[model samples]
Target chain A: MSRRPEPVQVVKERRDAALDTLVGGLPYLAFLGIRFERRGDELTAVLPFRDENIGNPLLPALHGGVTAAFLETAAVVELAWSQLWPQMEGGAGAAAPGVRPPLPRTIDFTVDFLRSGLPRDAYARAVVVRQGRRYASVRVEGWQDNRARLFAQASGHFMMPDLSAGPGAAFADDEAMDPAPPASEPR
Target chain B: MSDDQYLRIAQQFIEALPHARVLGLRLLSVSPGHAEIELPWAAHLVGDPATGVLHGGAVSTLMDTCGGAAVMAHPAANAGAATLDLRIDYMRAATPGQAVRARAECLRVTRSVAFVRATASDDDVERPVALMQGAFTLHAPRLAGEAT
Candidate 1:
């Protein structure tokens, strides 16, 4: 019998694959101009400001929704990067056929607007508070110039899939394939 | 000011935000202390492409816009408002191929703050996809003699 890849190795592979396709596979994040930078195991979300992201044109502040969305995406992407397995509804072997890695479902989200987000490059940092068998909790904070001067802080809960339970479990998803072409390319 | 004037202001407020336009949010109607907005579905906005469901962030945008609009339409709000805090509970994923509607009401208004409660649904109002509650910070103080 071929030796099965350890669950930890599988998670690392999945995390690397997700980073490669972070843009094309996730179209919405691209639309919002969200990018990721990984340093060792830490992931930071970068949101470059565009005219479309401005909420208060007068103050030239980023839209509350834009900030919130950035924070939420940061939380989800961080969870995946950390390779925390959420319990799957169907068994691990019951894999769905797709190239895009399965993303956790958001159960609850709360955002606190600490300060108005100025129109500029914004960055978010997310930390997974806890990872249980079926659910995971994450805390994310967004800032512009000074990290201490946080524009927004958020807490969210996501449902994870159990990926370590079965063989071929982690590599079954088509997301294991190379990244897709850019959105501009024809399907 | 009259509700009609406040309604017009609310519409302009929604139009001014480019992100709101990106989501294709339409102002359905507005009355004093209340606002309604609609979001048309698009393929690129889906959070879960496998399931083809709208992303939670899109829903949050819709709800936040409505909540802010409700504050703008409030009679006591002489100036615009900003979101102080917002909470969303995802009851279920929004069905794909359906437009989402969000309606928010300013439950109360004080000198410097306005409270809002809102909901987002696709076809059926009874079975909502998400629920939201938020508070907005009023730019100006309450109008004279306005209800507390």
Candidate 2:
């Protein structure tokens, strides 16, 4: 006979489920090869280095755009995952099931590069500064070797959909994006 | 350096980068203090599969590449430039299946730094998908007597 599942184990299961929902659904995150982990309430995003990610082969440094993309994805994933954490809505205890938050739409983002990103597994952590009915603001820090010596810091504002509308409302594309520019134009 | 040489360097810079090639970025034009680039939409580039929208990260990559190109195009810095800071404001989600274009202008450049501003739009130039401002550290050109 199996013993009762511990509270810690239960929380981990819920978090993993939440991650599957978030990461599995987002193709770009998969394309970037981003992974998520939890230590207590903190969430970290991991981007493992690949040959294709190098921008300056001479410096052998990670591309600036790759790091920025990782940071932004980290912030968004953290925000969405928070809704599934039991402690977020309720105080401590096992997480309640089926409270996944709606995915956010980025309104603005800023990344400040403090150092050149070396080729390695990069990690990022994010904190939600404010979460309101219609918007949320978050701050993210990215580092490789030492957390104190950060490679970059980023902050962003995201538009949160109306909760009363429906779960699918947040993903709706009300505005049309760019029309495909002519690819034949000479560079 | 002549404008033609600057253009050549800018083009080579984009082509040399593997990540830019992966994103399918094309260097459209580069003049003194200004550069324009284009990114074609791909299915793997979608941020939200539910909506088939291009990820904000993809747009950020386009902006960063354009801004760096603008800084390099500036006549003052013959060497190269690195990103110091970049801020992007997402005005709207890029509609799926549409190519996005980014135009960047190096607003100012000093002894050690360059400032740039850029806008990314789909088909309509007026309706932008994202706006960006960035600062880049410039590497000064080598002097006549300076050793390599």
Candidate 1's C-alpha runs over 4 A off are: A1-16, A84-98, A164-187, B1-9, B140-148
Q: Chain A structural similarity (TM-score) per candidate?
A: 0.71, 0.78
Q: Which stretches of candidate 2 lie over 4 Å from their true place?
A: A1-8, A86-101, A171-187, B1-9, B140-148
lDDT of 2 by residue, A1-187 (tens): 9977559877667656656666675778877888888676677899998877777677777778888999999998887766545443364432334444557778899999887778789999999999986679999999998888888999999876554466565534543322334558542
lDDT for each candidate structure: 0.78, 0.80
Residue B21 lDDT (model 2): 82
The per-candidate count of clashes, in order, stands at 5, 4
Candidate 1, Cα interface RMSD: 7.4
What digit string (tens of lDDT, one per residue) describes model 1 on residues B29-142? Answer: 998788899999898887756667777888899999999888887889878788989999888767677889999999999989998999998875667888899999997223
True-contact fraction in model 2 equals 0.72
Candidate 2 residue lDDT tens string, B1-148: 8867766776778988888888889988898889999999999999877678899998888998899888887888776788888999988777688899999998999989999999999876777888999999896223222368
Error of 2 at A39 (Å): 2.9
